[model samples]
Target: MSFERLNQINDYRQLGNTNLYVSPFCLGTMSFGTDWGWGADRAESYRMFSLYVERGGNFIDTANHYTNGTSETFLGEFIGNLRDRLIVGTHYSVFTQRGDANSSEDRLRKMVQSLETSLRRLRTDYIDIYWIHHWVFGTPIEDVMRVLDQVVRSGKILYVGVSNTPAWKIAQGNAIAQLRGWSPFIGVQVEYNLINRMAERDIIPMANDLQMGFVATSPLAGGILTGKYNQLALARQISVSEMLARIDCTTARASLNQEIGRLNLHNLAISLELMEIARQIDRSPAQVALNWLLQQSDITSTILGARTSQQLEENLGSVEFQLDMTQIADVDAINPTDSGMLYGDTVYSEVQDILLESARVVDLNH
Candidate 1:
C-alpha cells in the first residue's frame, strides 16, 4: 500500500475469453492531445504515458475521432519502440466528416476506411482491439458481425469490441455470430461509477454471463466522483430534481439511451460520501472510487484518464489498496443501484421453484 508497490507490475490477465492478456487498468488516451483544449499537449502526454508504462500498465484505449485524430497521432508518436508488446485499441463510428455522404453514411465502408486511417494514425499495421464505438438504430447487427468477421480475418484487427451498446444487442449479435461461425465481440465498454450504476443492472450481468470483457469507462462519472463537484454543489443551492433538470446531458450519454442526468443533488450526495470515505481511509477520492470498480469481479478493466503525470501517478495508486466490505456496503446503502424488473435477484428463482419443483433442471450457469 505504498508508492513503491504502485511501481511494481500486476500480473496481466486474459481479456474476456481470449488469449490477449492485458493490464488491470487501461490507460485512456482521450486526453493525449490538446486539440480538445482540455487535453494534454505533446510533452505532458508523453509524461503521462511514460508514467503509466513505468507503472507496468500496458492496455491502452483510444478512438479514431478523438481530439479530431490527434489522440491516435500522439499515441502513435509515444508507442514507437513498445508497439509490439502494447495493447493498442481504438474506436470508430463517430462519423465526424459531416456532409461527406459516402464516409458518413455507410457503416461497413466507413469501418474499413476508419481502420485504415487509425492504423496510419497509430503508426501500426493492426489494432489490438477495434471497437465499433456505439450502436446506432439503423445499422443491422447481422451486417456488422459479418463485416467485422471479415475484417478480423484480414488481420487488420486482432479482436472486436463494442462500447455504449445495449446488453441485449450484444447477446443477440454474439449468438448470431457464434451460429454463423463469425468473430463476435469479445468485450464491452460502458460508463460505470459510484453515481451511475446503470451498467450493473443489465450490462455487467450480461458481460459476466457471456464472458465478455467488461471495461468500465468514466469510472469517476465525469469527474463527479473526484469530489470536485462537492464544492460546486455547496455553492449552488438547488433541489436534486431541479438541479438534474437544469443541467444539460452530454450528447454521448444521450445517444447511448442513458438517463439525461448529471451532477444533481443525489449525485452530489454520493460525491460527499466518497470524499468522507477517502478521509477515513486516508486515500485519494479518485483512488477510493477507482478501487470500488476494481473490486467488481465482472469488470475486466477500468479506464484511467489523466492530463498530467501527477494525475496519472495518483490514479495508479488505485491498485495499491482495497476497499473493505463495510465501506463498500456503506457506499451501496447510500447510493443503491436499482435492480429493475427481471434483472438481478428480481426474477427466475421464484418461478422456477414452483414450475420445476418435482424435477428442477440444473442451472446452465452452474
Candidate 2:
C-alpha cells in the first residue's frame, strides 16, 4: 500500500454510513475528573481538551456513569461555546436506578432517565450519537431499537450506536431495525488494540459487512501497549512475567494463563515490537500503537484517552506519518489473528472443493 498518511485530527471520517463526519481520534473524557481518585484535575482536563480541539479533533466521548458523572460535567464546561462544532457522544449502560424489572417499558424509562441526566450534565440539547453502551441479557434488542428510534424521531439523538456488544446480537438488532423501518445502528464500539485482535475475528468484520463503523476503545490495551508499563498482574499468585517464565506457548496453556490477562509474553512482545519500530521511526510507542489502529481499514475511529497535555500532543503527532506494510506485517506476526472455526482463508479451504466434487458452479454474489 502507498505509505503517505494524511494529517489526522483534521482528517475526518464518516461515522459508519452517517452523514456526520468525525475526527479519527475521539477524545475520551473518562480521564477528565479527579472523582475517580486517580485522574487529571480540572485545570489539566481543560488543557487536554483544549489541546485536542486545537488539533482539529471534533469527536468527544463520554458516559453518564463515568466517575459518577463528573466526566460529563467537566466536558460540558469545556464544550460551552463550541457545542455545535463537535460531535458529542455519551453512554447509558450500567443499571443505576430503581425500576420495575417487568418489561421493556421500565427499561426504556431507565434508559430515558439516564439520557436526560447525561444531557443535563453535558449541557447539550441533543446528542450527536447516543450509544447503547452494551447489550444486557435481560432487555430485548427489539425494545432497544424501538426506544432509540423514538428518541431519534424526537430529535434527542441524531444517530444511535451499539458498543461493547456481541457481533451476532448487533447483526440481529440491526437486521430487525432494517426490516421494521426503525433506525439501524450506524456504528459500533469495542475494545480493540494491537494486543487484542479478537475483534478482528468477528466484531470488526460484522460491522464492516453491515455498513456500520467500528470504533476501537482501549486502543492501548489498558496501557500495556504503551511500552512504558511494568506493573505486575495482581493476584495471590505470582506476577504474569514470573508465571509466564515457564514458556509453554500451547493453546491450552495460553487459555489457562488467561487469568494473567494482557500482560503475557505475547502481548509484551507486541509492546517490545512497537518500541523497536517506534525507535526506528522516531515516534513514541503510544503514537505507534494509535497509528496502527488508525490504519486499519475497518476502524472508523479510535478513542484516545489522555490525562496530560504531553500525552495528547504525542498521540496527535501519530497521524503525521505512516507505517509501511513491512512494519504492519511484523506487528501481525507477533500474534496472527485467529479467524475462528472453519474459516476458509485461515483453516480449511478444501471443504468447498470436496463439496463441489469437480462440478462447475456459477458464482453469483449479491
Candidate 3:
C-alpha cells in the first residue's frame, strides 16, 4: 500500500502528557529478521511497514540484536528519509559478545556510543525514544541513568524508556533521578496479556502513580489468544507441540494452555468463546485481545508484532471499537488476572469456578 492508503489507518490516543499523541497500537519489528525463526520476509516486511505508516501508526519498536541487526538494517531501508515521521524506539544492553568491556566511566560513554551506532544503522540522527532492551550485568543503575541523561541532553535521544525492568527497581531509578535532579524514565515496556498479569501487582499501579506510560508487548500471548493455533488444534492435526515448535512456547502460551485446560474440558471451548466474542464485537480474536489492553487506564500503547501485512491489519482492528461494560465484564470473568481480582473481588472468580466445574461434569458424561 502507498503512504496515502496507510495514513487511513489513523487511530490516535493521548499519552500521559497531552503533548505526545501516539497511535493506540505501536508496531514492533523484533520479527523483522529470521533469528528466532518466523519473521517477515523482506517484501512482507516492507508491505507491513508501509501499511502501518499509512494507517497513521507513527511509533515503531525494534532492538539491536533482533535477527542479528537484520531488523535495524531492514528498518533503515524501510523508513528511508521518512524517519522523521516515525517515533522510533530501538533497544540495547542485551547482546555484547562481539565487543570489549570498558571501565565504569567508559561504560556510560560506551553505551551512548553504541546508541550512536544504532542511529547510524537505522539511518536516523535521533531516536524519539531509546529503550534499554534488557537489564545487563556489571552496569550500575546510576551509570546507566547518567549516560541516558547525557544522551537526551545531547539530543541524540529525545526520551528514555526502560523495558523488562522490575517495578521496584524502576521506581528506585526514577526516585534517584528525581532527588538528584536527573531525567527520569517517561515510559515502561513489559510483557502483559490476559494470561500474564503479574505486572499488575506492582507495575500498573506504579506507572499510574508516576504518570509513566506503559507499553504492553505480546498482548495476544504469543498467538494463543489469536485463535489461530486453537483452530488448528481442534482438528487434532496440529497439537500444542506444533505450536511450541513454531513459536518457542512463550510464558503466555504456557499459562493460556494451563488456564484453558483448567477452565474447559477441551481447549476448543475457550476458542469458541473467543470466537463468539469476536463475532459479537465485529472484530477478530486478535483485535479483541488488543482492545482488552487498550481498555486499561495505565496502558498507553500496545506493541503489536506481525510477520505480514495481513497480520498487522488483523491486529489493528483492535482499535476499532470500545467494549461495552457487559462485554468487558464477560472477558474479565473468564480470564482473571492477579490485578483484576483484588482480595474482596471474588464474584468473578466464583463464577469462573462454577462454570468450569459445570463444563467438566458435562465433559465427563460425554
TM-score rank, highest first? 1, 2, 3
Clashing pairs in 2: none
Which regions in candidate 2 have their CA more than 4 angstroms from the true location?
1-4, 96-106, 230-260, 341-366
TM-score of each: 0.83, 0.82, 0.78
Task: Report, for all candidates in order, the number of backbone clashes.
Answer: 0, 0, 4
Itemize residue pairs with steric clashes in candidate 3.
6-54, 6-55, 7-54, 9-55
lDDT tens digits by residue: candidate 3, 280-307:
8678877776776777656788898887
The per-model lDDT (C-alpha) reads 0.76, 0.76, 0.70
Candidate 2 lDDT, 257-317, residue by residue in tens: 3533664676776777777878898888888888877787677889988778888888888
Kindly report which residue stretches of model 3 are placed more than 4 angstroms away from their true locations once superposed. Answer: 1-11, 96-110, 237-272, 279-282, 339-366
- Candidate 1 lDDT over residue span 1-366, tens digit each: 011122233557678999898887899988878775567899999998888888788899999888889999999999999998889899985643443433432267788888999999999989999987756534567988999999999999999998876788889999999999999899999878887777877888888788899898888877777876565445688554554455444533322223434646667778888889899999988988887777766777889877688988888888888777787676666577776543313322443233233442344555
